[model samples]
Target: MREEELSPGEPAPRAREPVFLLPGSVSALAIILVLIQFASTMVLNPDGQNMLLYWFAFQPLRIVASLTDPSLALPLLWTPFTHAFLHGGWEHVLINVAWLVIFATPVARRYGTVGMLSLFLVSAAAGAAFFAATTLLEGVYLVGASGGIAGLTGAAIRFIFQPVLVAHHPETGERLVLGRRLASLREVFANPSSRYFTIVWLVLNAAVPLMPAVIGAQLGVAWQAHLGGFIAGFLLVPLFERRLA
Candidate 1:
């Protein structure tokens, strides 16, 4: 069962909240990206210019530059929060949207909207840091919300492992405890239709790096970014999602 539509054993619904309190904060990120794409197209100069990185994008060098060069420092350095909203193309935006809708809703329901924002920002930074660290050895630019979505993937893994006691019925004092079952994650994985797709995801990730290495193609996947993002969420989600017995 999806998180929003809880099982028959779970708690009943509550009153409506404000609009900003969205179930998936990643949905907001997706909307922001659409705006960014439109703005980039309208404003981009074709004279071999890179305004996206210089002004709109998050520059890793800026952090180092801010530490050493006082002149390079801007008073308002809130670009990191904005960077994930900017993407290279429709493909980049669509992929993030797909990932967000698939996993982020459950994450936000468990942790709330602010917590979702934390996963996105921290995961993005973690991914960027990994990218930056690797570029020191071999230069490459990392773009897109794959890293943020990877964090959600990691969080989902942890969430699925919880011991959920689902009680049912009330008036006649009846309750059937599923009692620490695999109802949560199994609902998504224990399906014949999805088995092949899950295998392809893992296989593609494993094979992408080898493709570039084997074919002498300079381009390769950001395996490190995926790794970093996953680690961040796997480590951080428990801190945000705390429930008393």
Candidate 2:
């Protein structure tokens, strides 16, 4: 009945395409972040560096001060989204880039470029909001892409562990499928991979706040922002995911 039945002598076909590298959007984002950080650190003067942070970094004190003074409100509004693009140092950006490539690839494939962008913006804002709500410290400047990275990680868990449905190709007998279903929070935890990841992530977050004294270094982990971004990504991914046919 199938066309392959009449072509038994023909050579077998290849399997479905696999992504061996980072997608365009994710790669571009990483490059842009690295370039900006490079420019800020190497090319810019001390004043320029301060100016960039003043204009872009999310500052909780400024947001609160803006309540009484209207002029500071613009930075407050934009800083939440802008801060995700900036980083503290080389190590900060590299770690974020790694996480972004790993988790964002699947999200980008499933949700498309626009969806990924939206997720980044919303999650970044949520991360900033959570940090502001929890921290009593004034003049705190939050910078880096970790919130967005955590977001992608959270979003990926929605469907990454599910068993993909496969069908045999008529010509080559290669297996293929449309996509996997989005799993609920409970279902996600039931899977071993997701369960372990969630537990470890929580443990790390809880432990990070105590690392400064233990390590004898000033390590501002911003665990609150990470938690906020993760929660936002986990809850909001369903809205961004395309409906399966």
Candidate 3:
């Protein structure tokens, strides 16, 4: 067939959208987490690592003590969010980072960098609050990004399973074919996949305290933090979507 010529006013076809998934902000956050883990494991001596935890990790006892002693209050303000950046070991951080990619990507794509960061920080802080409420008077330090990751996971569930949408840019006519509609609460619970997933997540986290006995090892999984973060993400994602709307 002979080549066809475009009309005088017709625009050329838009370029293919890139397939890259990791947004710059998400990659930056992931890199920061890995670097912190590397520093904890390789660069920091035992004493230095301990000091890092003391200053950054979330501890229920410290929060309680801060109520009476203002001198011990400085760390309390930051530890809630900072502890999500700290980890107990390589395995802990690695697992959290993996989940962060899986869960945070969808959220970052929908909400943009600012919304993703807001959800993460708020969830981390909420996790610390839950941990403190459960472990008050029990000297336990909470670390790792699982709580924040769980929040991302919960936020993702709001739209992850919806049908993908295909549209074109108004100006460029680009073949933009991604993203799903945010599901309503009724829709989420009505759908078997999401409902079952939520139930399973809740059950697993509820059983976190008993994990040591079941596995015969001390895993120190903070279930309360996970639940708190999940709840926050699940409830707050609509607000993010609304803001965008």
Overall lDDT per candidate, in order of appearance: 0.65, 0.86, 0.88
Model 1 segments beyond 4 Å from truth?
1-24, 47-49, 61-70, 73-80, 137-140, 161-164, 168-208
Score candidate 2 by TM-score against the native. Answer: 0.86
Query: Who wins the lDDT comparison?
Result: 3
Deviation (Å) of 189 in candidate 3: 0.6
Q: Tens-digit lDDT track for model 3 on 117-220?
A: 99998898888898889898998899989888888988999899777778888899998875687898998898889989998999989987888788888767
* Candidate 3 wrong stretches, greater than 4 Å: 1-20, 165-178, 212-217, 242-245
TM-scores across all candidates?
0.68, 0.86, 0.84
lDDT of 2 by residue, 122-157 (tens): 888889998998764578899998887788888998
| Residues 1-245, model 1: lDDT tens digits | 66666788898888887775446465676687777777776766754226565554555665556677876546216444455666777877787787887778777777778888789778877877766665643423456777777787667665554456767666766876543332233543564433444455556665666786688894546666676776687677767756533
How much is the lDDT of residue 180 in candidate 3?
A: 80
Error of 1 at 139 (Å): 6.0
Which candidate number would show the highest TM-score if scored against the true structure?
Answer: 2
- Model 3: what TM-score? 0.84
Q: Where does candidate 1 clash, by residue pair?
A: none
- Model 3 worst lDDT run, 10 consecutive residues: 236-245
Residue 204, model 1: lDDT of: 62
Q: Is candidate 2 or candidate 3 better by lDDT?
A: 3
Q: How close is each model in CA RMSD to the real structure?
A: 8.8, 5.4, 5.6
Q: List runs of model 2 lying over 4 Å from the truth.
A: 1-20, 167-176, 212-217
Q: What is the lDDT, from 0 to 100, of the residue 161 in candidate 2?
A: 88
